[model samples]
Target: MTTRELPMTVPSEGLPARVRIHEVGPRDGLQNEKGTVPTAVKAEFVRRLAAAGLTTIEATSFVHPEWVPQLADAEQLFPLVAGLPVALPVLVPNERGLDRALSLGASRIAVFASATESFAKANLNRTVDEALAMFEPVVARARAAGAHVRGYLSMCFGDPWEGPVPVPQVVRVCKALTDMGCDELSLGDTIGVATPGHVGALLTALAGAGVPAPVIGVHFHDTYGQALANTYAALQHGVTTVDASAGGLGGCPYARSATGNLATEDLVWMLRGLGIDSGVDLGRLTATSVWMAGQLGRPSPSRTVRALSQQQEQ
Candidate 1:
C-alpha cells in the first residue's frame, strides 16, 4: 500500500456513485485464443477473479463445441466454480445451450445478438431478425426458470461490413431484447470504433426509446484506444454497469478487426481515480491479471497492470 500504487481520488459530477463491472475474461477473453486453455486453468482463473472481488464473472459459454473449441469444456468448468458466492453468468446461444447451462444449475445467462446483419450472420449464422427469433424462446425459458438473462448487442457503434451503424438500428434491437425479458442489455463496441459523442448519442436514443440507463451496460474494446473514453461518456449518461476483461484478454473471433476488451485493471484504475467505487481490490485484481498473463505465456495488455506490477517489483 504505497502512494504510487493507487491513483488520487477526484470525484466527477453526474456519474454513478458505484459501478458494477461485468468481468468477461474467462468466456469472451479466452474464446479467441489460438492455444487451447485447460479447464483447470479456466476454473482457477474464475476463482482468482472472484477472490479479487469481481462479483459478476462470466464463467463460460455453452455454445456448441464445434463453434468454440476453447470453451468446449463448459460443463467441466462451470461445476468447478459453481459454488462461488457471486454471480457467474454464461452465454447460451440457443435453446440447446440454455438446456446445457440449466442442467448444471447456472442461474445467470447471456445471449449474444448483433446490431448489424453481417455480424449476426458471421457470428451466429443467422440474419438479425433470425437471431432474435432464435433467442426469444431462450430468454423466455431462462426467465421462466428464475435465471437472470443478459442480452448482448454487438456492433452497437460500428460494424466492419456495415460500416457506421445507425443509432435507431441499435435501439430497435435493444428494444427487442428488453421486450423479450432480458434483465440487462450489454451494448458492445465490437470493433472499438466508437468515439465519445457517438456514445452519448446512442445512450440518448436508447433512453428516448424507453430503455433506461440502469439496465444498460457498456462493453468497449481498445482497438482504437477509445474504450475508456467511451465508457466515461456512458458513465456521464448514468450507466452503472461495464463489461471488461481481466488484463485486456479478448477479441472477436468472428470479426478480425475487433481487438481486446477494455481491461478490468484499466477500468478499475480509472474508476478509482475518478473517486467512483467499483468494489474491486486494485492490488489483488492486478496480481490476478499478472498471474493469468503468465498462464497465457504473454505480458498483460493492461497499462494499469504493467505499471502497478512494476511498482510492486520496485
Candidate 2:
C-alpha cells in the first residue's frame, strides 16, 4: 500500500512542531501477556521499533520473574540491543532490578509510582509514600552510575477504588519523584478515564507548581477511546514526550478492567496529520505492529494498523 505523506509545515497553532515518542511496546506492552515471548523475538521487536524511527524504545523490565515472568529474560534481552544507537530504557522496580539492569550495561531505567493509595498497595504492595521511598535509593544508585532515570506515576487521573484522583495529590507525588532525581516523569492514566479537560487542568496545576512541561511525558490508555485526544491536550500544553505501545500491547495487569495503551500507530497517525514531526514512518510503524500482532496470535488493536494493513491487502 502507498504510505500517506505528511505535511512539513506547522499545521496547527496549538501543537508542538515536533514530538518525541517513547515506545514501550516491548516491556510495558508485553509484560502482561499470558503467553511467553522468546528473548530473541523481544530483541527483534526493539530493533524493528528503532528502525521504524522510535528514538527511545523500552526494551524490557528487570522485575523479579515471579512477578512478571514475561520479562524474565531481561538479562538475555538487554545484551542483544545494548549496542543500538537509540535509547533503550528498561523498567527497574527496585534496587535489585537496577542491579540487574546496570550489570547488563543499561544506562536508562524507569521506576513506577502510583498517585492513589489503593493502586499503590494493589500494584506495588506498598503505600504511595513507601513506593517513593523505595525508588529514592534506586534512582540515587542509578544516577551515581550515570544512568538516566524516568519515573512513572500510575493512576494519576482515575483509580478504580478511589474514583477521581485529586490534582493536589498527583502534584505531590510528581514533586516527590522529581525531588528523588528522576531525569523525566511519565504521568500514566492507568485506567484510561481521562479526557482533554482533565488533562489540561492537571497540566496547568503541574505547570503552576513549576514542573516544566518539557520534562513531563503523558501515558494514557485508550479504554474510553480518548487517548489520542488526551495526547493532543498534552502536546498543546508543551509536553514533548508521549508514551505509546506498538501494536497497542499493554494494560494494567492489576487493573483487569483496563484496556490496551494508546497505540503508537494511532498516535503517529494523528501526529502526521497535524504536521507534527515524530520522526516516524507511518507505513513502517504499522507494518511492525501488524507483524507483532501475528506474534501475539491476534490482530493489532490499533485502528490505524488495522486499516493500513487492510489497505495493503487490497
Candidate 3:
C-alpha cells in the first residue's frame, strides 16, 4: 500500500499542528449494542485500541445497569486496566455514578449536560440549570479527590425534542462547565445536525466568552454525513481536540436516525492529508476496525477505510 503524507506546514486557520483524538468506542460505542458483548471482548477491544495509538480512551460509563445494561461491568472493567498507560475516562452522570467511577480508580471523568431544556429533562431528569447545578458538586468533589474532569455539552447543534440550539445557551453551558474547573469541554453535536457555519459561529461565540482554545474539543456524529466537515470547520476556528470512534461503532440509541460518530480512521486520514499529525496509523486503525466489525458481526461505516481496503484488494 502506498502511504500518502500531508505537508508539515500549519493550516491557514492557525489551528494547532497536532490534536488529541479521544477514542470513545469502548464505552459510548458499545453502550448501545443490543447483544451483550462479553466483558473479555470489551477489554480486548480497548487493548487493541491502545495498541493503535489512542492515548485518551473513554473506558466506560459508570451508570446504573438499569439505565444502560451494556456497560454494567464498568466497575470490573475499569479496575482490570491497571497496567495500561493511558488516560481512562469514564462518564459519571451524578454523584452515585462518580462514586462508582472513583471506586474503580478512574483518573479522568466526564460529566455531561444538554443545552436544550427538553433534552436535559428527558436525559438527565432535570432542567438545564438543574443539571449544571448537579455537576458542580460532582466536579468539586472529583477535583478534591485528585481526579481530572471533562464536561460534555450535548446538543450543541440541534436537539431532537427541541429545535436548533441557540449559541448563547451553548456558550453559557460551556462557560459554566469550564468555570467548574473541568480540564476540558467536549462540544457535542449529539444529533449531528451542525453545519460548518453553525459550528464556526458557536465556536466563535464560545471563544468570545473567554474560553481557552486548547480546552475545547468537538464530538460529532455523522447523522447528516457532516461530521468530518464540521470537524474541519471547528479546526478552522482554532479548536484542536476531537472525539471519534473506531468503525463508527456507536450511533445514538435515543435518536435512531443518528449515525455513529466520525470514524477514527477517516478522521486520521483527513488530518494526515492536511498535514495535521494525529500520531495514529490509519492502516492499523482500519485493521482494528475490521476486527471490531467482525466481533460485532457488522460492517464498518468508514468510507475511507472501505475504499482503501477495496483498492488494496484489487
* Per-residue accuracy of model 3 over 1-314 as CA lDDT, tens digit each: 46432224445446568889999999889987998788888898888888888898899998888888999998778877646988899999999999988876777989988888988877788999999999999999999999999999888999887879999988999988999889899998988899999999988888888986788999999988899999999888888899999888887666665678998988887887687878787777888888888999988888877877777677
lDDT of 2 by residue, 137-170 (tens): 9999999999999999999999999999999999
Looking at model 3, residue 222 earns an lDDT score of 94
Number of clashing pairs, model 2?
A: 0
- Give candidate 1's TM-score: 0.99
- lDDT to native, each model: 0.96, 0.91, 0.86
> Which candidate achieves the best TM-score against the true structure?
1
Over the stretch 142-242, how does candidate 1's per-residue lDDT look in tens digits?
99999999999999999999899999999999999999999999999999999999999999999999999999999999999999999999999999999
Which candidate ranks first by lDDT, i.e. highest? 1
Cα RMSD for candidate 2?
1.4
lDDT of 3 at 179: 91
- Position 287, candidate 1: lDDT: 87
Task: Give the runs in model 1 whose Cα sits over 4 Å from its true position.
Answer: none
Q: List the residue pairs that clash in candidate 3.
A: none
Model 2 global lDDT (CA atoms, 0 to 1): 0.91
